[model samples]
Target: MQLPDKKFVPVMITPFNLKAKVDLDAVSRLVDFYLAAGVKGFFANCLSSEMYSISEDERLDLTRHIVRYVKGRAPIVATGSFGLTIEDKADFTQRIYDTGIDAVILITGHYANVDDDDDVLMRNFDRMLKLTGDIPLGLYECPAPYKRILSAPVFEKLVATNRFVYHKDTSIELEQVKAKLAIAKNDPNLEFYDAHTPNAMHSLQMGARGMSSISGNFYPEILVWMCNNASNPDKQEEVKWLQAELSAVDPAIHVAYPMSAKYFLRKRGLPVRTISRAHALELTPQQKQTLDEIYDRFTGWCDKLDITPVNVEELMKPLIHLDPPI
Candidate 1:
C-alpha cells in the first residue's frame, strides 16, 4: 500500500466514556473530527492510543472499529506488536494488519536488551517480518516503556530493507532529522513523519514529511495549515508565527497527555470524556486554568491567521449511525 502523501497525520487517542471501556461511539466521533480537520491520514493505535495499557482484545476491536469508521477515507496505520516475545509480537502484528490498516507500525527497538547492539534489534525485527509476511511496515521511535532512538547505522540498516517505508522520527536534533531524511530520499517508498513539534518547521523546511504528535490532538488545523504553507516562500513569516504557537502546545499539555487532550477536545465541543485508564492523570484546578489560558492564546493565534477551527458537532452529525455499540 502507498503511504499517505498529505502532511499532518495525527497519532489518534482512543476515547473512553466514564466507565473507561473502549468508547466505540466516541471513537467514531474522534475519527470524524480528525477527518474534518483535514488530517491527511490517521495513526490509530500508537503510543497516543495507550497501546501499552490496552488489552489485546481492545486493541483488535479498536483497530477494526477505526478501519470500518474511516471507510477508506484515508490511509490508516496501527501499532499492535506489544507482546513480550518476538513470536508473540509478530502474531499480534498479523492480527492488527488483518483489520484493513494500510500499514502496521512496529515500535523500533522494543525488544532489545539494555545497551544491546543494532544486530540484536535487527534480528528481532527480521523475525517479526518473517512472521507477519508482506504487510507494509512503518517504524516509531516511541519513548514510552523505553526510548531507543535508532543509531544512524541502525537506521541505515533499516532503510536498506526497503520494506520499512514510513518512519516516525521522534528525534529533536536537526542533524538527526537531516540524516533520516537523507535515508528516506534513498528509497522512493520511504517517508519520515516528525513527531517532535518543537522542531516541526525546521524538519519540514529540511524535507521531513510532516508532523505527528499529541499536540496535534489540540490544534490540528494549526498543524494542517503550517504543513500546507510551510514550504511557500511567501508564507515564511506566518509559518514562523505558527511554529512558535505550535511549539507552546507540547509543553502546556505534556503535563497530562490523553487526559489533557480529552479535556481540550471537550472544550472544542466533541463529546469525549476526560477519562484515561492508561495514564489517569487528574486535571487540577490550576492546570485547568492554565489550559483555558492556553486555549485563549491558541484561538487568538488562529484568528490572526484566518485558519479554520473544526466544528465538532458538525463533524459528528454524519456519524450518528455509528452511535450504537459494536
Candidate 2:
C-alpha cells in the first residue's frame, strides 16, 4: 500500500482497565486521539503495545478492533512473527494478515537466533517468503528478543525481492540510515521509517518516509509537526531546536516505558489508565515527577511553535469519522 509523504505512524500502546483487561472503549478513544493529532497510520500490536505480554488471541482481537475502528481512515500494520519456527511464524503471519491489515510485519530477530549470522537469517527469511506466498511484508528491527540489525547488503537483497513495502529501521547511526536510504531509493515501493526519535530531522531530511517512534505515544502532534516541517527550508532553526528538545527528553520518557506513556497520555486527559501488562510496578514518585517535567516541556514547545495540541475534550465529543485527506 502507498503511504503519504512525511507520515508519523505511532507505535500504539495497549490500554488496560483496572483489572488489566484490554479496554476496547479506551482504545477507540486512543485511535481518535492519534488521528486527531494528524497521524497517518497505526502500528498496532507492536513492541510499544506490549505485544509479548499479551496472548495470541488478544493480539488478533486488538488488531482487528483497531482495523474496524479506523474504518479505512488510515492503513494499519501489526506484528505477525510470533511462532518459534519459520513455518509457524508464516502461519501466524497469514492469520494476522486476514485481520484486514495492510501488511504483516516480521521482526528481524524472529527468523534467526541472536547468534545466527546474516547468511542464516537470510536463509530463514527466504524460507518464510516462499511459504507466505506473495503476502506484502515489512521488516522491523525490534529490540525485543534481540535487535538483529539488517546489513546494507542484506537490506538491498530484501528490497530486490519486491515484497517488503515498509521498514522500521532502528539503526540509530546516521551513516547506517544513509546507507539504507540509498538502497531504499532504488525501490519505490518500500517506505522506510526510522524508530529513533532523535534522528527525526536528519532521517526525514535524508528521505525517510516518516517516523514510527515511541515518542509519538506521549505527544503525537509534536511528532506530526516534525514530520511536516523537518524538510522545509524555512523551519531549520525551529526543527533543530525541537530535535534537541526531543533528544533531551527521550531517555526520560523511557524510564518506565508504556506505563510512563500511559501516565503522560492520562495527564493529557485521555481515558487511559497508567496500567500496563508490560510494566508491573507502578510509577515511582520520582518517575512521575520526571514525566511531569517532560509534560511541561511539551506544552512549552507547543506554545513556542504555535502548534495546537489535540483537544482531548473535543475529541471526546460524539465521533464523526471522516477519511483523512491523505
Candidate 3:
C-alpha cells in the first residue's frame, strides 16, 4: 500500500447500532460519506469507535468489508488494540496488514503498571517493531487506564527505530500535547497529529504537525481545510473560528458519537446511518439535550462552511433503528 499523505484528515469512526450490533450498512455508507466529504482517510477500532467493546472477529470483519468497500479510494488504517496479549497484537496486526490497509495504529496493549518501568514498555515497543518488519505502523498515544503513556525518552527510542511513522496523540491534556510536541518536533519522519481539537492550533503553531480527532469524524471537510491552513498565517482567524464551532458541543456525550456524527452526515447529503455496539453507555435526558445542543451548534457552524446539516428527525429515525431488521 502507498503511504498516507500527511495532509489527510483521518476521521476516527464511532460504530453504532440501536440494537447494540455493528451496523455494517452504516459503516459502508460512512466510508463513502467521508470520501465525498474530502477526508483523506479513516481509522477504525479507535476510541471514538469503542475498540475494546467489539470482538476480534468483528474487527477483522469490519476491516475486510471496508477494504473491499473503499477499494483504495483513500487509505484505511486499522487500529492495533487487543487489550490482551503482545502476541495477540502481532498476530492481529500481521493479519490486518495482509488485508491491504496502508497502515495499522499500534496502541499500548491491555496492561497496567507498565509505565513505571521504562524497560517493560520499551520491550513491548521493540517487540512490536521486530514483528512488524516494514509494514508501516503508527502509534495511537492514548494514556488511558488500559494503556500506558509512552514517556518522552521511550517514545523517542521507539520512533528512532523507524518501524513506526505516524503518532496520533489522543492524550487530551494540552500540557501533554506540549510535551509530546517538544519531543516530536525533532523527529522528521514522525508525523505528529493532535487528537485534541481544543489545542489543535497551538500544536500546529508549535511546529508539531497536524491533527486526527474524533471531532474530525463528523466534519471531515473542515478538518482537512484546517490542516491545509496550519502553515498559513492568514488563516489563523479562520481556523480559530472553525475550532470554536467544535467546542460548542459537549465533550462528555460520547454515548452516541456515531449517532451525533451521522446525524450531520445525513444532513450533508450522505447515505450514512448511526449505529452502536453492545455495552454502550446509556444516556439520560440531560445527555440527550446536550447532544441536541451539539447538533444545533453543528448546524450553525455548517453555515460557515456552506454545508446545510440534515434534519434532526430524519437522522433520529436511523439512530433509533440502525439496521432495518434482518
Candidate 4:
C-alpha cells in the first residue's frame, strides 16, 4: 500500500478506436507516455476512463490489459464499486483484485444515496470491508452518481479501519482538505491525493502524498514537477508561480474533458483518437482553439522551468516501421 513520495498518479483516460472499441495498442503507448512523464502510478478504469460508459466485461478486460501491459513497472489501482448492492460491489471488488491491481478503489457515491447521512455511508463501507476481507482498498469521491464528500469525522473513522490505504480527495475546499489531512497526515498506511489542481500546492504543503488531478491527463509533466518540488524551500517562488499558472487554466482544461485531454495528447503526437464514450459530442472549434492555446502555454511552462516535455515521436519510435518500401 506504500507508494513513493510525491507521486503523480494519472486518472487514466481510455483510448478507443474508430469503432469505439478499446484500442489496446494505443493503451500500451499511453502507458509508455505516462511513465515517461514521470508518473509514479496509474489510476486506471476510473471516471476519466469512462467507467460508467463501458460494459462490465469491458471493465475487467480493460483493467486486465493495463495490469498485464504495465508488467509491474508501477502500481495500478481501479474502481471496483459497481452494481446495485454492497454484496454485488464486494463480488466485483474480488474479481477486479484478481486482475493483479494493487488495490480496488470504491466510489464514495456507491455506498449511499446523495441524501443519506454519513452514518449510512459508514455502515455500507463497513459492510463492504467485512465482505471483501483484507484486500487493499481506496476511496474516490467521484463526481458521477453524486459526489459523496466525506466529513472529517467519517474520514477519520474510515482511516481507523486500517483497511483503506489510498484516498483521492475531491473536497475542493481547502478547509475540508486540511481537516481530513489532519487525521490522515500521520498515518503511514494511508496516502492522500488531492484531485483539485488549484489546491495542489497547498494540499501537498499540508501533507498530501501527491496529486491525481485531471490536469495530469493534459500535462502530467507539470503535475509531476509540482509534486516533486511543491514543498522545497528553494523552489517556493517557482512553485508559487507554477501554481498560479496551473490554477488560471484549471477550468479551461476541464471544458469538454477526456476529449479535451485526448485532443491535448494528440497535439503532443500520441496515437489517441479524440473519441470518448463518456462525451459523445465532438469538440467545437472554440474548444479546440482554447486547448491549442493551452498547449502553447504548456510548452512555455516547460521552457521556463527547464522541464523537457516528453517527446511523443521518440516515445513511439519502437511502434513505427523504419524500413524503406521496396
Error of 4 at 65 (Å): 1.0
Q: How accurate is candidate 2 locally (lDDT)?
A: 0.93
List the global CA lDDT of all models: 0.82, 0.93, 0.65, 0.93
Candidate 4, 63-95: lDDT as tens digits: 999999999999999999998999999999999
TM-score of each: 0.94, 0.96, 0.80, 0.96
The alpha-carbon deviation from the true structure for residue 171 of candidate 4, after best TM-score superposition, in angstroms, is: 0.6
lDDT of 1 at 316: 65
lDDT of 4: 0.93
**Candidate closest to the true structure, highest TM-score:** 4
- For residues 1-326, what per-residue lDDT tens digits would candidate 3 score against the true structure? 33223454565564555556677777776766566656766776666665666777777787888888889887777776464677777888888777778888887644235445777777777776677678888887664445566666776787778776678876677777778778776777777887777766667766655777776665666666666665567666777887776655536434456556555454454444444452344445675566666656666666765664334344344544433421
lDDT per residue for candidate 1 within 1-326, as digits (tens), equals 33224489999998886678889888888888888888988998888898877889999999999999999999889996678899888888889999999988988757686588778898988888788778889999888767888877788988897778689987788898888788787888877899988888887888877888778888888888877877778788988988887776668788888888888888887777778877766899888887888889889978998977887667766554323321
lDDT of 2 by residue, 1-326 (tens): 33236999999999987789998888999999999999999999999999999999999999999999999999999999999888899999999999999999999999888888999999999999999997899999999999989999999999999999999999999999999999999999898999999999999999999999999999999999999999888888999999999999999998889999999998888888888888999999999999989999999999999999999978876743331210
Q: Which sequence of candidate numbers ranks them by TM-score, best first?
A: 4, 2, 1, 3
lDDT, residue 21, model 4: 98
- What CA root-mean-square deviation does each model show from the true structure? 3.7, 4.7, 5.0, 3.4
Error of 3 at 158 (Å): 1.0
Task: Give the Å shift of residue 32 in candidate 4.
Answer: 0.2
